[model samples]
Every structure is written in structure tokens, then in C-alpha cells.
Target: MTTSRPFADIDTWVFDLDNTLYPHHVNLWQQVDVRIGEFVGAFLKISAEEARVIQKDYYRRYGTTMRGMMTEHGVLADDYLAYVHQIDHSPLQPNPAMGAAIARLPGRKLILTNGSTDHADKVLQRLGISAHFEAVFDIIAAELEPKPAPRTYQKFLDLHQVDPTKAAMFEDLARNLVVPHQLGMTTVLVVPDGSKEVVREDWELEGRGAAHVDHVTDDLTGFLQGLSKAS
Candidate 1:
């Protein structure tokens, strides 16, 4: 919000799915995380506990656990994607305020996510905001590459014909904002509201004065509403 004429020049609004779109307290991702480990365990013929360690390690090393599996074990991406996304989406609900605020914003709005379009569609449809977005640029669209990767961001820009300077990206991961900020897009980090207990890594929540983040917000609905008010 401190940036000069915030949203004044932004013609493209980009948002990350998962925690960035829905509240972290919903804990929907927890089910996916568990399923991911289970898939890994089944694939490797290992215990669930051991597979989780590898899953976390791969996530840290490859920007995504699926990528690591592909690189190290020659696993098919579709196999992993299909398995990890089978969790129930019942935890999500429509946020009329958030949808209304987003609908009020001018220009094209898109979801840039590390997830598959199938997963993004489910989340958006569940939230009842599917009509508000122009499109979703997902991991498959990025050729299986995930965020925090510069080339993936470039591919997304090229695909959408988005000018970084005129775009704003909102994400839950601070690291994911690094590439967007470096590309000259205004980067916003969305954090948990603390109404529910959610565990996050120190780096994931650490943003404030970080050079990569231009803004931070806990209440996305309120934050977008405020932006609309000023505009």
C-alpha cells in the first residue's frame, strides 16, 4: 500500500492459489501434503514417515517435490499430480466479500499457481470465484516447472503477454515473490490471520523489509477492499 499510486498502473492482477487464495486455517493443503507423502511411500515401497522426509527434502531442493521425483526417479508428472490432488475440497467455501472486491478491480485477473489447472479449477469453483478470473497459469502450463524459478515466470509472462511493470502478484510464499519482484511486478505476501493455528516455516512468513516483497496482508478480502477504496 505504500508504493506510489498503488494499483494505479497495475493492469494485470495475478494471484497464487492455495493459501494465497483461501485462508491457511482451512488446512485443505494438509490433506494434499499427506497424500503426497502417501504417494511417495507407495511408489518407493517405503513407510509413510520416511516418505515424508524425502518429500520435504525434495520440496526444499527442487522447488517442488514432484520435480525431484521426476528428476531422481524418472516418475511421470501426471502420475504424481493426479494422485496428490485427489483430496476433498469440502473445506473451502465461498467468500462473497473477496469475490466482490476482486470483481471490482479493473483489468484482467489470473491465477498463477504451482498446482495443476484441475486443482486450481476445483479451488476456484469451490470458492465461487471462478467467473472472476480470466485464466489460470499452472505448473503444466509452465512445463512442470514451479515458482521461484525465473524461467517459469518468463514463460508465464510470454504466454499471457503480461508486462511485469504493469502487473501485481499476490502469493503466500515469500520466496515465490522474489522472481516477481525481480521482474518488476509489485509483489504482495499473504499471511495467516492467526484466527486458527497454522504452522509455517520461518522463511515462508518472513517478508516485512525483505527486498522481494512490496506489500504484506493477513486479511486478503479486507486488503483488496482497501485497495479498491483508494482507487
Candidate 2:
């Protein structure tokens, strides 16, 4: 059970936009997943099956498939971001309860995403929580670098003037929270609720008991609502 006391001192609430903010049953991110595969296939001029293999391989090696493409194939970040993020926001809807919970959190809210600002904005707006976040630190802001990278986390901190010890980070991927945990921020891993049939890899499901992860929750709204007011 999550209690309020542990988070009392945390003032800055940083959240990852995709799987963190909403539940997986919505299949909102699944759209992006399909788009990434399509983009990889078309861009690499390879078969869809081959693209899937390369996508997962690249994602495993690099924090993002885009980074892998950039490093190996000289793909432009702008084009890749534009192509992958052209997903439908129809699957997602306004979650007033989530917005209310987020609004209740003490201090400021920010989004730290490996995606573009446009994609983050679209997701936030579709979920009706765009107003709650003060700013979004996106891939462009981090110079195309993604999370799990120490330098990217440091750059976000420097750019936002955030105190890691006084902040909390909510992310879907446990590996993405490692850098934040190392930097003294409270790391919460948002896992899928398992209410839906979403395909996932074995590695994607790892890190549940990792030392760096401070908390794990399938219900983001409940977790946010349960937090005690920041001291």
C-alpha cells in the first residue's frame, strides 16, 4: 500500500507521458507501436517481418528505435518523430478523475518524454490533463536523446532547475526510471493492469523487484490520489 508520508517532501511531480499516465487497455500506445514498425519497414526498405526484428534489436541496444536508426542509418530525427507520432488519439479519452488527482499533487507538474512535444501535447490534450502540466521536456529538448541515459536526465534537471531529491518520477519502463533513481528521485514504475490482452516481451516485464524502483502500481490515478500532500 502507498502512503502519503514518504512523498511529503516531494514537490516536483515528473511523469512520463505514454503508458504512465493512462492504462494500457486503451491501446493508445499500441497504435504508436504499430506505427513505429511501419515506419521502420518503410524507411529501411525492408520486409515487415525483418523490420520487427530490427526494431526490437535496436530498441534493446539503444534507448529508442529512432536513436538506433539515427546512429546506424543516418535517419533524421524530425522525420522519424513526425512519422511515428502521427497516431490516432481517438482511443484515448478525457480522464477527469486522473486530471483531478494530478491537480491535487503539490507543487508543479512536468512531462518528461522520449517523444516529441507535439505527440505529448496530443496525448495530454486527449486525456484532458494538458492543463495540469506546466512544461514538457521532450526528445528535442534533450537533443534527440532518450531516458535511461544519465546525461538526458541531467539535462532535464538543469533545464527545469529541479531538485532530484525533492522530486518524484513516474514512468512505465523500469529501466527508464533507473537514472532518476540514481539521482535521488523517488522512482515509481507503472505496470499494466493485465485487464487487457496486450502483447509484451519478457524483458519489458522485468525489473519489478529492482532496487532502483521505489514503487509499482497498475493504477496510476489511484496512486496519485493516495499520495499524501507534499510537505
Candidate 3:
């Protein structure tokens, strides 16, 4: 259905964690979001309402609340990562089909996330696809810099030695794919199935743009399956 070849000549595959790897219907991020609000409230001694407002604001402004907190409030990155990612990851089911598809892909596969390595590990393990990844370039690995920040992508490439032209990046947020597309990586926007509200912001919803994204899919497992077959 996509005009561009989805996996054509892609030697390296980069993926965002969180909502991209797993279905957003699981609402795993809601747990983390609630915890982030709690952390913000407790740290700032603010009301729940105020904390919620700041949480979304920071997310929009800084690409992540942790980055905002660190820059503005002098919060420690490790402490924030530890506290915010302390939710139960049991809601995600084992997805061997996805694991198999990823396994069939050529060359290297990596996880690039705003989340911590521990959280990424748990999610990948729960999905039974942890072994498929060459490495996870987490927020900490990027020195607390999150995606949508062009510097983080350059760091990821430098550390992994990945060629942008021959790689593909898969992400849930359309905005996150912009820098990757600009860097010549094939960009795929993974959205939720039959969901009108895929993201909270207009910018996130604009991922289907031809300028940045080459493909869009609702079912990540099925998408990977198609890629495996085509490969």
C-alpha cells in the first residue's frame, strides 16, 4: 500500500521502544505517565493538577519530562529514570511472531528510546524479542538527550556506526521520525489500529507525511511479518 519499498536496501533497523514495539491499546505508558506526574508533584511540592500540566508541557517542550526536569530543576537523570519506569510490565504478551520477523531482517537491529535500558530490556524480554537487538541506545546512552533532538540521532549513529542511507527507523510518534528521515533513513510511523486519537498533539498525528515517513502501519507484528516475507 505504501509507495516506497518498505525494507528495500535497509541494512540497519532502528526502533523506538514504548508504544512502537507494543500495541498502544495495552496502555503501558499510562502507568509511567501517572508515575511521572507523581514524581513531578512530589519533587516540586505542587498540586496534582499543576504537576499534570507541567508534565504534558515538558513533554511537548523538551521531548521528555526527565530532560525538562534535569535542565530546569536540576533533577538527577538516574533518579528520574529509576522512579518513572517502576511500573509492572506484565500487561504485554509474548510476541514470537514479531521476534521471528525481526530475526529475519538483515544486518543490525537496535532500540532507540527516550526510556531507560532497564525498561527497554523488560519490554523486549516480555515480547520475546530481546535477543534480536544488537544494542539499545537509551536516553542515558545519549546523555539524557531524547529523540526529535537532532544531536541524539548523530550520537546514535556515531556509537552504532550505522549508515543512515541504508537504515530504517520505526517510531510511534511522527515527529520523532523527522530527524531520521532528514538523515536519509527510511521512516515508518506505527499507529494504533482504528484509533482516531493516535497521539495527543497535532504534530504527532502528522506522521503520515511523505516528506518524513515512507510507510505507515497499525499492526507492528503484521508489518514486520510482511517485511520478513518480502525480504
Candidate 4:
């Protein structure tokens, strides 16, 4: 494989937990999606179909459904987080290849996720890569502020004492990379393999501000493996 110099000089490696670490084909988010709709339906006393529309609306309007629920319906953030993350983690099997690649990186590794720590822990444990990370900074750690929010990024950097210039953030969402890029961290967008069509949803599409993205990779394992080989 051809090697690249994308990750050079990075001392702190930050990763987003969902589709970034695992392949999108696993479809773990589909379960979470159903649960979110259920939670909303139950909470709002509305039908599931109606709740689904509201769920997507909240996700678009507030950056997260939990934020919108809390703001509009006085729902507890933890309640929503716990309820939605209760799915089985069997889809994510042990990935020693990814573990080995990450282990070779010369830096502190951390997972910064919009999901709760419980969910992050389960995913990491299932992947057999839990020991490699120094910490998992979840939504609660960000005071329920989700990513793409500049303050959350600053909080992650401050709490972890990571130098943005020496840090690199890997995320599946293009919009989330913008603040990291502006903060001097190398930003990598992890898109799904064989994504040829224009992404239809506003939230699903890559940001036009993708100039902030320093690099884009579809295969995170291979990308990280290349970094390992270069080192």
C-alpha cells in the first residue's frame, strides 16, 4: 500500500466512536435510531411515526435529539442517553487489526463521542481495544453539548490538556471537523466506502466547509495501519 504523511507530528490522537472507529456496514446506528424514536414516542405520548419526524427535526435543529428534548420537553439528558443506548453490541466484534494499528501510534489515544460513556465503554470493550485508549470523553463530560459545537471541542482539549497543534481528530462527520481544523488540529473525515451518491440529508452530507478537513479516508483501519507502517 502507498503510505502518506497525513498524521505526522501528532502527539494526541482523538477519535469519534461511532462510524469512525467501526465500519458503517455494521449498522449499529440503526438500532439507536429506533430506540430514539421509541423514547420520543413514549416521552411525548405521540405515535412512533410522529415521534420519528420530531426526532429528525430535533437532530437537525439542536445538533442532537437529546438537546432538543431537554430544551422543549424538559426531558432528562441521562434518561434519553440511557434509554437509546440499550441495544446489544454484538455487531462490533473484536478487531485486533485495528487494535494493533492504534497501539503503534505514538501518542495518547482518546475517544470523544456524543454518546454516553456506558455506550462508548460497551463498544470499546466489544472491539477488544479498550486498553489502548487513555480516556473516553462522552456527552456528559461535555455537559451534554454534542460535537460540532466549538465549546465542546475546547472543553475536550482543556480537560485533556491536549495541544491542538499537536493533536489530530478523526471523525465520520465532516461538520465536526471544522472547529478542530480551525483550532490547528489535523482533521480527518472518515466517509463510508463506496459512497458515490450525493448524501441527501442535511445532517448526513459533508460540509461545504470541507477545506477544514485535512484528509479523507473510507477505510479507517487501513488508514491507521498506513500510519503505523510509516512510523
> Candidate 4 regions off by >4 Å?
1-5, 195-202
Tens-digit lDDT track of model 3 for 73-135: 999998898899999999999999889888998889999999999999999999999999999
Summing lDDT over every window of 10 consecutive residues in candidate 1, give the lowest-scoring window.
Answer: 1-10
Report the Cα lDDT for residue 110, model 3: 97
Q: Per-residue alpha-carbon lDDT of model 2 for 147-204, expressed as tens digits?
A: 7789999999999999999999999888998889889999898989988876666787
Model 4, 1-231: lDDT tens digits are 122325678999999998889887677887898899999999999998899899999987777899999999999997898899999899899999999999999989999999999999999999999999999999999999888799999999999999999998999888888899889998888877865432235567565345787778888889899988897
- In angstroms, how far off is 121's CA in candidate 1? 0.6
- How far out, in Å, is residue 98 in model 1? 0.6
Per-residue error (Å), model 1, residue 130: 0.3
lDDT of each: 0.90, 0.88, 0.89, 0.87
What are the models' TM-scores? 0.96, 0.95, 0.95, 0.93
Best by lDDT: 1
Model 2 TM-score (2 dp): 0.95
Residue clash pairs of candidate 2: 4-228, 8-231
Q: Give Cα distance to truth, residue 69, candidate 1, Å.
A: 0.6
Positional deviation of 195 in candidate 2, in angstroms?
1.3
